[model samples]
Target: MLRWRPWLPPLLPLLSLLTLLVLSDLTSSSPTAAPTETGAGWSPPAPVNHLTCYFCENVENNYICNRFAIDHPCPAGTTFCRTLHIMDTRGGSVVVNKHCATEDQCRDDRVGCLQQDHQKTCVSCCHSSYCNEPVPTNYSNAVRQPKPTAPTRAVKSAGAAAAPRLLLLLAAAASRLLLLLAAAASRQLLSGSRQL
Candidate 1:
């Protein structure tokens, strides 16, 4: 018991080495470490929650449909793809619009008969991604019909959230490594003092 100080000097280095080894194992074995190595230069995209719809609006005789192949990301809370076809006064003016629609807007197909013109709007809702690629033909007998089952296009996966977590893990590992090294150095100094 009187010479406990000398024994402590040797044990300190052993304890520090063991801690370093354990920390190395933890850092390497962490799940986030693998992705961090591979995705070093890459950042994940944001999470996609909105539907991309083909949007076009044209007046009759313009036949300007598809003029712009714009992929519109619908506003949040709007989950369905919609196609609206309108006929004005015996096709005098026809307008078609494709866009993201809400559930209420896609409740049913509506036809309005005005004094000088008849307007027919076909509302269709689709749950799948980019399901409104094709324009709707029948607007008069509208119902909330699901698009036919077909091969769905692959959506881009977003990885924006993962990068930050990986960075935090790396920081933690580096800090732990630094602490271990400091402990080892202190142990060395104590042992040297005992020799003096």
Candidate 2:
């Protein structure tokens, strides 16, 4: 002989709903995952700090620049220190310009030393503090352009990306199943109550 519990029928639907909610929460992606993790395509924001550089302009010679260069802090968004050396072959004269430079400016002018008949120009860029203090007089020893920044977002692999979608789909399906079960359980409880 078996005894039917009157309260269990209604409670079954509530329990199933609770279980589905918990499962959905557990399967969801973490909110802070992108910021905390350094994946293949994810990079942290660049740190903002005072960047010091050797600053001068049209100093005419490397030795003069070395003696007269001022240590100055670069403005916001200007990361590299630059030195532009210009040599006039026919005139036997050298002109130097040193200043704080942005990455774009460095990239645009980093063609090394190019000679056009009687004149040669070279641009050097560096990131360390006072890196432009020792200006290069010629093309052979000039610094190359600074490297570009890392990408802002992470690239997802096929399987790794598919996993979250699969979990979401499973959760959605489970929710529907739980709702159907609740509907059936409610109907059974209503019939039982009506009979009583």
Candidate 3:
């Protein structure tokens, strides 16, 4: 025996719409998805591919690092080549370190040198190969260069960055709408079944 219920017709449209929404969400690719970490404290950059840098650390002489720098491939998540030069103002000792670094490591460093209590630290970051070979110079009060601009790479515009956030917000709103519609439809079905 086959029985056709009148209440089921209204739910068909709602079920179809819900299925479509779910399918669309699953199919559409999201640009703002969280990136996989390569290793400890390493999130790969999107702008550049593999980078080769000079790796060395010397506490005595700045020229020794540049003279005997190892051409090393950067790690998966490291994007910039960093050169750190620390000068002890009291003892007149210079420490030079050139290695592959992440963006966060170079975030606070600027073009000119920064002086602390008794030591002046200068950190310079570059994107190209062997860019960190040149050791950072000592602090000079006369040289006041302007803030260095971002590296020559594809920088996302404000609108482009906001687009992903907007998509997520819309998706959330759609989900809430679907839940409310389902609840309303269920209540309607319950009342209709009770009457009959």
Worst 10 residues of 1 by lDDT: 108-117
Q: Give each model's whole-structure lDDT.
A: 0.57, 0.71, 0.67
* Tens digits of per-residue lDDT for model 2, 77-153: 99888888888885344788888888777785464777777888777888778777765546666766455444422
* Cα RMSD, each candidate: 14.5, 14.9, 14.8
Please estimate how well model 1 matches the true structure, expressed as its whole-model Cα lDDT: 0.57
> Which runs of model 2 end up more than 4 angstroms from their true locations?
1-48, 90-93, 145-196
* TM-score for candidate 3, residues paired by index: 0.42
- Which has the higher TM-score value, candidate number 2 or candidate number 3? 2
Question: Backbone clashes per model, in order?
Answer: 2, 1, 0
Q: Give a tens-digit lDDT track for model 3, residues 1-196.
A: 2244557657767765775676577557644534466544444446545689878877566677777878768877887888877878763547888888787776754545888898877777777777676666655421222333665232545666677667767666776766666566667667778999
Q: Which residue segments of model 1 deviate by more than 4 Å?
A: 1-47, 59-63, 88-93, 109-119, 139-141, 147-196
Better of 2 and 3 by lDDT: 2
Whole-model lDDT, model 2: 0.71
Q: Quote each prediction's TM-score.
A: 0.40, 0.45, 0.42
Which candidate ranks first by TM-score, i.e. highest? 2
